[model samples]
Target: MTSAASKTFVRRLGVLLGAAGLAAPLTVAMGATAQAATSACTAGTGPYQAKAERFLGRTVDGKQSAADCRAIRDFQLDHGISPAIGYAGPVTWAVMDLVSQQRAAGDNPNAAGRCPVNKGRIACVDLTRQLTWIQDGKRLKSGPVPIRSGRDGYETRTGLKKIYWRSIDHWSTLYEVRMPYSQFFDGGQAFHSIDGSVWSAPGSHGCVNMRRADARSYWSLLKNGDDVYVYGRKPGT
Candidate 1:
């Protein structure tokens, strides 16, 4: 072949090879996406299938379906469960159970009279239900909101305490983490905001981990010397 013709052929071949390379990655990416979607929404029945179905308001047939998988997966993702693949496993069911109890509290979280009512402007932490609220002589000032207390070994201390310190932007030297809107009621444990999901599990290191918005609200509503009553028992602990 002539030099000019050979050069033109080489250019065309290069273009074709580049296009093929691009298509290869595209195809692999598509396959990976499909696999992920499939894994994230399995059809196999989990141990707590029936309870999960009932909690999710789905038909309690005690079986896993495509629809059930999707619904359960969504709930898992919302609550920050790992491998949120729509599995009705114990973790998912446990979270659902906690949610049910929280909802049952409704507007009157203190209806059971667990947290003292007469304390003027007091913060109540119900460790059993993983809930917290602020009340003033029976009037709900704020919350009944979700909270992630300390883990099994590092259970948040129970009993009446006071907010001894307040730091809007506190950094934990021990854990090397940022504790935003920290209000310390105990030695090292405090009410603070974490960047991660408050419902992620295993809980914190004796601190009451709150969502960002909830922590900010707590910062605004609480101050030094405010009463804090922590009661009940955290489930795993």
Candidate 2:
């Protein structure tokens, strides 16, 4: 026989877990409800979403399902993605691509290395991956975003650099173009969203080009004096 106070404490813990969606209560239709939650994507959806559905272990028909989002979020957590919103956003997609690339190449999918010592909010770039990740030293805050660095001629300088400047809407006088959410690390190289094909090509002259949304996110995350470490050679380099 348990004490009343002990029983109340357990019940309160259950409520907190339930509120956080950590544990669902014992519902009437646990079996049937499970099926409904794991919905398949319907037709007319983008191939990318279908890929995400499959990656999430959900039916890849073409549909939106909370179950899929939860799976995606869980995957993100395992991969060191932050917030774990469950939405297959730009950051998620970028990570997915990186994983796919690694799998295809028979390489390790967990592609993180030792971060810079004492570098708070470090921005890490894997040239081999063509990916960027922002983290507070050991903890990832955002990214694994697809990025484009200098092409054949003008290779983006590698090695560790510190962010020294930031601009919300900066126009590059050297390139004569607009660089949104620009965080400058190397002398003339910065991480900024550009109008180019970052998904398929390393199209930048030398600066890092990110997707518009990712640039916005980077702007919100990084600040001056943050360490930026660019490592590994870009694929096919």
Candidate 3:
């Protein structure tokens, strides 16, 4: 269970960052409305929501912002990951720890090579194929996997990113989603694993989802600030 203090921390962080909406818990029927509200702010409208503004300022190829209500609107059009209040609760943290433990044991996803820790290695994944690979010394070492893309057609974006944010045991028990950046773009899509084979299908709303096994494997190889190359499908399609 999360200490009451931790819950407060998460809530404060959300409000200070203009991400208080994210802190709101999701519901089966109202979840869509909540996420859609994220993009309601215009470039200069409302109180200076620093987190929202910062997210909105970033552009994918000069387009898309974490605060784009249109993106939120798009999500409602098809429904997507609900950043419900408990989504980033204590359970998420625990799972991340487990994944870290397994990876620290020297398990290699592709048996290809070490994940690149250099300035030039290509770190990327293919959601269509459910594979996350690292650029070894000279080649791409692939890890077996399955991912959930956007069910609403807001596909996982294709781009270059550095590990930006991370949270353990997000959402529910044993589920952790590693975010390369803030969930600003398309409401901050994530790379996470769900409980069943649902991930193998187009299960996620827009996040790059993986199976529990594959997610665990990735947790071992990746770290914050690392670069990742996403191929096949644009993020938050």
> Which candidate tops lDDT?
1
Compute the lDDT of residue 137 as modeled in candidate 2: 54
lDDT of 3 by residue, 97-206 (tens): 32333344343443433333455544556543445656655554545343556655666666667666665565522325333222222235666666544322235656
Q: How close is candidate 1 to the true structure, as a TM-score?
A: 0.84
Which ranges in model 2 have alpha carbons more than 4 Å from their true place? 1-99, 102-114
lDDT of each: 0.87, 0.69, 0.46
lDDT of 1 by residue, 1-237 (tens): 666875576567647756754211111123554465345454478889999999989999998998998898889889999667677888889899999999898889999898888779999999999999999989999988999999999999999999999999999999999999999999999999998887888999999999999999999999999999999998888
What is the TM-score of each predicted model, taking all chains together?
0.84, 0.54, 0.40
Comparing candidate 2 with candidate 3, which one achieves the higher lDDT? 2
In model 1, how large is the Cα lDDT of residue 105?
88
Of models 1 and 3, which has the larger TM-score? 1
Better of 1 and 2 by TM-score: 1
After superposing candidate 3 on the true structure, give the runs of residues whose Cα lies further than 4 Å from its correct spot: 1-122, 140-142, 172-187, 198-200, 234-237
Query: Which candidate's TM-score is highest?
Result: 1
